[model samples]
Target: MALRVDGDSPQNFSALFDLRGTADTGELRLTSPIGSTLGLARWSPAEAVLDNGSRTYRFDTAGELIRAATGADIPLDALFSWLAGQDKSVPGWRADLSQVDAGRINAWRDSPLPRAELRVIFDTP
Candidate 1:
């Protein structure tokens, strides 16, 4: 994943991730390029938790956990919808699905200040 925020330096991340279950209840594991575990996150309606080897972080809602990691409040439901080939509008973000057929997606946010961009590429149909 790559993020370019207006004032902050661009942030680039390369990881193998596994996301499963629904938007409200799921597990997200981020692994480094060399196959080492970076962090593991699990969430349910009741709670959200992130284990990063050295420490654990907990929050009341999954959104909080996500925001803490991404520095943006991305809607989980919208993300899932996009992965399924639908364009779900997000308040401050725009998504380019033109290349989705080729396993590429581009999204950007310009509202609420600190414009940012996110890109995702996958190797699957």
Candidate 2:
């Protein structure tokens, strides 16, 4: 996932995430841009774990772990649906799906502070 958050501190974070499981049980592995293993995040209804290289970080929720790692307030679950071309509405954000057929997605946040935009382009596999 290549995420660029432009607001107070402009952050360009790109990671490879393998997401597996349902709402009750799920695991997500995040890798560096060069494909080196960065961390493995596993979560169930009652537990969440983030194993980074030599250290392990635990959080109350997957969202918290993700936020701590990425420093961006992104809606992970909704993002999966969005990438699938679903029109999921995240509060304070709006997406443009008109060009999704062209392998592109553009979204922006207008409320709760500095305005930011997110653009995603899927590479042909």
- Candidate with top TM-score is 1
Q: List residue ranges in candidate 1 displaced over 4 A.
A: 8-10
* Candidate 1 per-residue C-alpha lDDT over 82-117 given as tens digits, one digit per residue, 9 for 90 to 100: 777799998998998888778777888888766777
lDDT of 2 by residue, 42-116 (tens): 877677788988999888887887678766666666666666788999999888887777777787777655555
lDDT for every model? 0.80, 0.73
- Model 1, residue 105: distance off in Å is 1.2
RMSD in angstroms between candidate 2 and the native structure over all alpha carbons: 2.9
Worst 10 residues of 1 by lDDT: 1-10
Error of 1 at 104 (Å): 1.5
